[model samples]
Target chain A: MIPTIPQPRLLTAAYTAYVVTFFVFLALPLVVVAVFAFNDSQFPSLPWEGFTWGWFFGEERPVIGVFHERPILRAIGTSAFVAVCVSILSVGVGLSNAFLFNRYRFPGQGILYVFMLLPLVIPGIVLGISILVFSSRIANGAWDIAEWDIEALRPGLTLVILGQFSFIATISTLVIAARLQKFDRSLEEAALNLGASRLTAVRTVTLPYLAPAMIGAFVVAFLMSFENFNTTLMLVGSDAPLTIAMFDRLKEGSTPLLNAVSLLLMLGSSLLALVMIAFQRRG
Target chain B: MKAEARIGLILLLTPLLLWLSLLIVIPHIDMFLVSLRERVGVGEYRISPANYLTFLTEPLYLRTFARTAIMAMLATLITLLIAFPVSYYIAKMARGRTRSALFLLCLVPFWVSELVRTFGWMILLRETGLISTLLQWAGLADQPVEMLYNDAAIMVGLVYTSMLFMVVPLVTTLESLPDEVIEAGYDLGGTNVSVMREIVIPHATPGIVSGCIVVFMLSLGNYLTPTMLGGKDSLWFTELIYSQFIVRFNWELGAAFGFLLLLLSSLIVWGMLRLTGHTLERTMG
Candidate 1:
């Protein structure tokens, strides 16, 4: 665009080549996954056999694909449920914390804020293990107090949600708090001046102002919980998300069925991106 | 800070404070103590530093830790190298819808799960993968070649996984530089190398520091990427930490290793910030 700015011809050629190579590096692997999904070979790897839709549509007895796989479907269902619960819990907690920090301050609020965001700073693996240890200690103490014989306490779905929420809620709080920083309080004040209760003012004025951010935060929590593997893997006993399930399949060696799963995941995420982009354009 | 607001603050903050303390603060404290203990008998433990000592004494653990740290740093460096040009293009050259589209390109891949992304690499690079198939078709090879499970594979996975973290920050900082600065440098007879060294790199310091810090931490703490791409032979430190907890059920040793990782990563990131003459507040952004 700036003709006189003068990029040398050699440098220009090099830059163009670099750009193309980088794009190929970023994109080609993902494309390969989709292309190989339809290969008739049982393995996801190679030797291009003729295309078949069996990977996407097959019978239960055949066990050739993900379709009609109850275990995987149940895992999907569990993940959705956990993600929903995490979204609601995180948004509620995050909103309340954001309100506290933004509107009202108490002693040690600074320390409290740091502690809340620690989950984001610390490794997810560490967070998962810490929660597991803490819960087990509490459960063990309680069980001992009751003097009742029981199985040693181990992590469950509840602990998984708690582990994820330990950090994700903090992320929600940070996002909402950033939104809150710019939000004017005069609308709430005006409502209060007009003889409305504080609760009424918040419900009528503040909540509406915060609704978009709340939705954004909820989506963040849901996605993070849904895709979270490191933390959830430690806490999940018999249950698994798509990530954990996929990891299991990978460890035992993979097949084209898993490739079908990868294809579906790719399609699902692309759809999510398009929808978000469309939503942003509308806004 | 007002007495009249105390009741409201208490009411709003109690649940949050209780939850954080119970979940985060207490667990970290528990981990600290657990990391210091020795299991002497069944259902009995005492304060000892054997776990930490073991990490120091074991050559396998020590070598893995050193390798993991070196590889993480190397990955961070490569990511920075790859990201700088692309970030510069998006921030300075591209405009309007084109710029937005390019920026979106870097982001869209991240939304897919990391597991899926790593699987994508395996599909292309494994012995019977796309690459091998292509080579065989071209008569370059007699059979499929194994491309996965090596140092190069791990590096590829690491760089691919963390490149976005590097680019986004670099773009953010570079976009703020006025075009006139570069124009001024050129008018003063600055060549490309001189201009890049004296102006562009200096201008991009905060972004560079932040991006490197982030990429390093993410790569160092990663468990899934290395295990998936590097196969069984990969001795990533996180896998060591993971094996302690999940495989051996050794919480004491795992907690020690976990703390060591946290300590090492934080120390390295902080030292980097100091070396680059950036404050924690500025670089953490």
Candidate 2:
């Protein structure tokens, strides 16, 4: 390392101390969360209860582990289902956005490009509320005018997916577009020059090149959809996602079972994060 | 364009048009329209600005709104101060593996849901939690201290939630600074502080502005962190919006509050970009 000057010993020591403290502060809460997960107690707080797997595996009436908890399990399933739908939809729309922005120039393209970023700048809560208001208005109009009730437009999982897709598509677009910008046009041109049809050239050459980005965007989008709370909270009706369920339980009271669920979430998300990093490195 | 290419362009544009219109443009327009409608009777309504006027007249709402804005700005500043040195250390001082590892450490917490992170803080700062226990054990307090349910607790949670956003951008900007530039500054007899003030801050302005924008917006719109950490006393503006929609079931008022929040945040972000002489494309994109 090149020092601008001989760093004063005091400054260097102080910086070192600060860095250590900063990391400790970052890790402390997460550490406490994980530790209390296994603690053999009713509460998630201190007083070093002996470690037990009851929070995960206990069959007792009071210590109904997260696995055995019906609502929690159902919420997990709901979250997974929503995440899958959001990822697929986001990636599909994202691919279209990438092609639209990258492959052609059109009227209002600059304005459209800025407009595309509107979802990112807007708050998540407002996004959800807007969608909620708009869809329900449509639903009411449909019923009133045409005597046809549109169930999908009501506050439910479908609206949840639509709400998340509003912004996630922007992200997937950014991810895929970054990769698309680096593409060599001649590669597709060469294929076209070799008597291959345009569709064949794109399918054989361009789409394969974009595969890594699509996959990367898929994973990132899935993680985001799974962990989302603010927008999902507004859109969810009966089938609450894991986050909302956990939030409700949190408000009711503290329990080691909540810690157990938190530990599981941490581990699951850590695995996804590692997968994302690996994909980024490889791509 | 030729016929085939024209049709292909139409196909390409269809999804963008539909997605933006159906999900974003139309909905927001509908929200604006809804915000202006006042319910006159059970099933009757009229165009009015009563909802917006209510926001202006309610002292509690006004006070809460101001408090949220001030707290969010304070949190953003705190996040910047804490992240700068750590980012510098990771970007300039730390070696290869250590740098990546430290950066990864910063990112890992964010990978989990914000609920989990806030839950962790709740466990630590609640009256009967670890910090209070430690204080008692250390003879620092005679009774358990209620660290949660206060503005300071909310600030702590907000900063923790947004620290990675600040660090990632700062590190990206700092890493691009050539070492020779720093060496040159030293060669010209510049001290560390002066070199940092002139060279580093200028180079990092785009990153700083972008990071601040994101952090400020996040802190302002945050519901889970403030609600969970600060409890009923949080007085966060987002809570007002949430209750109007969820608890009170007043869609018109909620829509107005949502728009006000949108307007305020957009104004602040626009002002920051202008003050820093950075475009949103350059800073955010």
Most accurate candidate by DockQ: 2
lDDT of model 1 at residue A117? 56
Q: Write the per-residue lDDT of candidate 2 for residues A104-201, one digit (tens) a residue.
A: 98889988998887787888999999999999999999999999999899889999999998999999999999899999999999999999999999
Model 2 per-residue lDDT tens digits across residues B32-53 = 9999999999989999999989
The TM-scores of all predictions, comma-separated, are 0.94, 0.98
Highest-TM-score candidate: 2
Name model 2 segments beyond 4 Å from true.
Answer: A1-5
By summed lDDT, the worst window of 10 consecutive residues in model 1 chain B runs over B276-285
What are the lDDT scores of the predictions, listed in order?
0.83, 0.90
For A7-37, candidate 1 gives per-residue lDDT tens digits of 7788877876887788788888778878777
Record all residue pairs in model 1 with backbone atoms less than 3 Å apart, i.e. clashing.
none
* Residue B177 displacement (Å), model 2: 1.2
